[model samples]
Target: MKILPFVALTATLFSSGAAFATEQTVTLNVANATCELCGPIVKGSLSKVSGVLDVQISEADGAAIAKVRFEDSRTNVPALITATTNAGYPSRIVQ
Candidate 1:
């Protein structure tokens, strides 16, 4: 049997495969963030974490949505959550 060409295989793989490293929207549920007071602290904390691109914390919902551009190699969700928690508000990965 003849083998499939390398270029064709490569194209198929790219079309079908899930992206490993890409900008992803992850929502964070935060505890104890209930006022404008909590906003800047959450923003600063998340900013310190490596590989974070965009962060938006809402005191109304007590949540933070981050547009994170990170390599699983450079950083991860757990680490980011820990950073938020350490800053003050307890946070968990919601998405």
Candidate 2:
């Protein structure tokens, strides 16, 4: 009986890979965010994406830096890039 329970636990852990999903944070460069209105638009777009947990935009010079946290299983860096670009903000991963 003890051996059977241990085998079942091991199998369960391997079967649902997504259950171990982790959060990821990325910084993006928003090149066109030179004005006050730009930050809100960029933030709104990022906030609307599914699995996006948080978004923070900081402006400096003529650009905006966006830090975003999201669940890796539901979204990714490419999706984040697309969101801002579609909003007319035009962003790229910082690294």
Candidate 3:
């Protein structure tokens, strides 16, 4: 029927839009993370954020770096930074 074709077209269009969604990775420099336990805290904070796929924490140059991978459609860099900051680890994007 004509309606069936219309429904199929609509489904295809919506599904195709989802295909454009991208996963982004960014490293955040957490200035307040100064101890060994800080890594887990930072990772936990980032993991709690919606759309965060993965979080890796490492120390470099006396600062903690949190590497985060997330779905761009659901979260952005600012949200990630806010999450860490709210958890007492204020951070900025590593250039």
Candidate 4:
């Protein structure tokens, strides 16, 4: 019946909506990235996270700034921070 088809269509639309991933980017101020070698280490740490898409590292004021892009549904700020901390670099959200 026409009503049954419409119901099926509506259900399909709603169900598929959940499959879309929400992406987010955050800048973290990383501490203990004093040496030049620290950039690669921080980048590697962030990259190891499951949902992290990309990571770029730069230095400012003797600390490292990590710009990270990740899938929000798969990970979050806390996970990112933990990744860096576990890698021996402590970090905080840049605001």
Candidate 5:
């Protein structure tokens, strides 16, 4: 009886946190992906970031474009930039 009410309240509280977690997708322009190897390197870097759900990197016409989906509560655009930049590929969010 009393325990049931407590369990319900706890479940509601935990579930509410899930409601606040938002998924965001962003496209980034990455520099220095001049070869076929660059795409894999960039993808590997972004994939290691926390909360990164998906990463698609394309190296075409000497440009690298990465489309990423992530949970905003655990990561953001800046973190994504840092991950790629640290891997020797500087990147910025495409407006």
Candidate 6:
């Protein structure tokens, strides 16, 4: 079976020096993300998210990845999806 891809919320946690943590991950298959032209759009969209520190879009792979580091208390995965959708590329929250 072919499971649908999750375009957002690929959060990863890393230890911070003091009391901070980072959830950085790769989201896949934003349906509208196609062609080389979609790269910038995807990246720009993901970058607008509050927790996201950076974004990387691969047109060849149809992937929109977000590097997010949130306050753990502030937001959660679903918010990430909303951010991408707000930018016009609605996405799923990958596990």
RMSD of each: 6.2, 2.8, 2.5, 3.0, 2.4, 15.6
Off by over 4 Å in 1: 1-20, 61-71
lDDT of 6 by residue, 1-95 (tens): 23323322222222332236445564545667666666677676666666665555544355554444443344565776676677777777556
Please give, for residues 1-93, the per-residue lDDT of candidate 2 as tens digits: 779999998889878676777999999999889999999999999999998999999997899999999999889999999999999888888
Poorest stretch of ten by lDDT in candidate 4: 13-22
lDDT for every model?
0.69, 0.93, 0.90, 0.93, 0.93, 0.57
TM-score of each: 0.63, 0.81, 0.84, 0.81, 0.84, 0.54
Ranking by lDDT: 4, 5, 2, 3, 1, 6
Candidate 3 per-residue C-alpha lDDT over 1-95 given as tens digits, one digit per residue, 9 for 90 to 100: 87999999889978766666799999899988888998998899999999899999889876799889999988899999999999998999889
Q: Candidate 2's error at 2, in angstroms? A: 16
The reply for model 5, stretches above 4 Å from the true place, is: 1-16
> Clash pairs of candidate 2?
none
Residue 56, model 1: Cα distance from true site in angstroms:
1.1
What would the per-residue lDDT of candidate 5 be over residues 6-63, giving only the tens digit for each residue?
9998899887676589999999999989998999999999999999999998875676
Q: Between prediction 5 and prediction 6, which has the larger TM-score?
A: 5
Colliding residue pairs in candidate 5 = none
Candidate 1 least-lDDT 10 residues: 64-73
Give residue 16's error in model 6 in angstroms: 15
Candidate 3, position 55, lDDT: 95
Clashes of each: 0, 0, 0, 0, 0, 0
Flag clash pairs in model 1. Answer: none
